[model samples]
Target: METSLLAFLLISLAKVIVVVVILLMAVAYTVLLERKLVGRIQNRWGPSRVGPFGLLQPLMDGAKLFLKEDLIPEAVYRPLYILAPIIALGCALMSIAVVPFGADIRWKGVDLFEIADVNIGLLIILGITSVGVYGIALSGWSSNNKYSLLGALRASAQVISYELALGLSLVGVVLRSGSLRLRDIVDVQSTHGLLSWNFFGGFQFVAFLIYLMAAYAETNRAPFDLPEAESELTAGYHTEYSSMKFAMFFMAEYGNMITVGCVATLLFFGGWTSPFGNLFPEPHNAILLSFLSLFWFVAKVFCFLFLYIWVRGTLPRFRYDQLMGFGWKFLIPVAVANIVVTSFFIGLRLPLH
Candidate 1:
């Protein structure tokens, strides 16, 4: 029993290490992807000289950030100011533990994919993500600067408002799938084929759109990035932060974007299900199917990520009042109405055509 437990522990640790490394790598490339894509959008070449079209740009950027001087303002709340970004990055990393990479395959009688297959996976993700807001709020308050505090306040308000819409928009998916388990949701989507994906139906497509927009605001991405609106708040909540500490916050933002994109893909685009269903069904081809499904999943996520970069270059920042009004008046109402309509359909056991 002791030997068995040791083996189990080592396996778990290995799985965790793999996940963390993958997330870190993804975060690094996401930055590069944004720079390149945004540069294209703005009609400029981005970081090509760094190392082979800037393939090494993230590495160089990371090195520079690490070597930079760390600064903390004298008036700031020392403890909380330092702790906030750590909390933000920690929470962001926690969500990925529950995310399934691909269909599970047995390896020595153990599932080789995903660290934990918690039954309430969706709830875990939502709860972890929601807690990340505290990081932003605390950072702002601890900064001891007017602009930082204002940015934090804006961030808090934005997160709270958009979270409601984001959560509500996903209810349709939960109701239709009849399970809160992320893996189960994917299984159902796979069984239903292309048309069965939540985004295929009209109402679900609207929910997906709402969810996407709200997610962008929740993450403080472009147009909705009022918290970091340079013109208004200088550098916003983390304006006073520098060096590695500041890099933590930057990494967390991109990490959260990838997380949201993955969740959206799983919920609306079929997590790891092939686009055309079992059109080429073969009992022994489950592994092949899984690969195809994962390919489609990654492809969908990449498109969303590209959209994020595109919007960052093309759109202008929203006015404070306009941002607040849109969330409260437009998104919230639409999300609420969507929930009601979806519930009605669910109650009637309406078959999705």
Candidate 2:
């Protein structure tokens, strides 16, 4: 028993370290990705001098942010001001703890896909994400700046409004899968092809659309990014933050974007499952299967992330009232109706999975 406990502890530590390192690297590059994609959308060169195709731009940006002078306003609440970004960044990373990767791998009898396997992983992720709002609110309030406070209030309110729709959007999938375990939800779509998957096959397209719209608002992306509208908020809640502290806010944003994409892939899309399942048989070896599934999972996530940047570059930001009304009037009702329809099919015993 002692040996097993030791092994488990060590494995957990390793997983945490691995997740943080990879998450930060991915978040950094996501910044570069948004820049490059937006530049193309605008017909302009983006980060040409940083590196080849601006690949090293994230590294350069990180260095620059760190080297810049850290500043604090004497009028601001120092304790809360300092704690806000840490809370924001920490909660963002915390949500990733329960998220399983594209494929489960084993090392010395230890599964390395996730840090935790709680039965209510989905709830845990959402709960942690909600806590992130506090960080934003605190950052803005403590900054002792009017624009920062306004940005925080707007962003937090939008998040709360959309969160209802976001939660409701998943009810259909949960009803069909009959499980809150994210892995189980993914497994339900495994035996099916693209058309039979949850988003397309289960006739839950309406739920998918609601989730997509709510996700954009939840992450403060364009059309819903009114909180940080440059023309109005002057960089929003993080306006008073400088150097690494300011960098943390952006890191949190990008990290949340990745998390949102990952969740969307696993919940709505046939995560890690190949479109032509029969054509690509699972490898006889466990290691090989892990890598192959990893590829498919990453590919699906890439598409979702691309969609994020594409919409950001294309859509105009919604007016604050429009954003709120859309969430409360349209998204919430559609999500509720989608749930009703899903329950009807479930009652009729449609073999959705």
Candidate 3:
């Protein structure tokens, strides 16, 4: 029993390290992806000089941010101001703990792919993500700046409004799958091909759409990114933050994006399931299957990330009123209606298959 406990502890620590490294790399390349995408949208060159088509641009940016002097504005709540970003980034990193990167691969008679296979994986993710809103609110209030305060207020309002719809949108999925376990959700998708997937059904499809839109808003992505609207808020709640502190918030945003993408992939795009499962039946080739699963998962996530950058380049920011109205009036109602319809259809037991 003691040896088992020690093994679990060591495995947990290793998982944390791997997740942190992956998140750091993902954040770095997310910036690169954004710059290149936005440049293409605007008919201009993005970063081309930094290490072969700007591959190393994120690295340079990181180095620059590290070398810059840390700044703390006068009259700020020093403790809260410093703590907010850490909370945000920490919560963001924590969500990845339950994400199954690939199917289990046995090595030395032990499964080595995922970290912890918690039964309440979905709940864990939702709870951790919900807590992230505090980081935004606290950062703004701690800054003691009017603009930062406004940004914080906007962020809080946005998160609250969208979270309702987001949660509702996911209800259809949870109900259909009959389990809140992340692995179980993935299993449902794997058994049902793309067409039979939750998002492919009529009511659930609509629900998925609502979820996607709400997710963008929830993450404060472009168009819905009024919280950090540079044209108005001057860098939003983190305007007063500098050095590693500001970087924490930046990292949190990207990490949240990856989290959102992973959830969507798992919930709708079949998790780590291959696209054409009909063609391939065997799941026993552990290493090969793991690679395929990881590849599919990453591909789906990258597509969503690209969509995020594309929207940022192509769309204009929403007016504050319009943003709120869209959430409360349109998204909320549609999401609720989708749930109702899904429930009715599910009760009828129609030939949904």
Identify the runs in model 3 with alpha carbons over 4 angstroms from their true place. Answer: 1-3, 106-111, 201-203, 350-353
Relative to the true structure, how large is the alpha-carbon lDDT of every model? 0.87, 0.89, 0.86
The root-mean-square deviation over C-alpha atoms between each candidate and the true structure, in angstroms, is 2.7, 2.1, 2.5
Q: Evaluate residue 248 in candidate 1 and report its C-alpha lDDT on the 0 to 100 scale.
A: 94
lDDT tens string, model 2, 220-335? 98989988999999999999999999999999998999899888888888778778766667787977788878888888888988999999999999998899899999999999
User: For model 3, how does the per-residue alpha-carbon lDDT over 246-325 read when each residue is reduced to its tens digit?
Assistant: 98899999999999998888888788777776766856776778888889889989988998888889889999999999
Off by over 4 Å in 2: 1-3, 350-353
lDDT by residue (18-134, candidate 1, tens digit) is 889988998999999998888888889887997788899999999999999999889999999999999999998889888887776655544557788888998898899899998
> Could you tally the backbone clashes for each prediction?
0, 0, 0
TM-score for predicted model 1 compared with the true structure: 0.94
Model 2 weakest lDDT span, ten residues long: 102-111
Please list all clashing residue pairs in model 1, or write none if there are none.
none
Quote the lDDT for 203 in model 3: 36
Query: Over the full model, what C-alpha lDDT does candidate 1 score relative to the true structure?
Result: 0.87
Clashes by residue pair, model 2: none
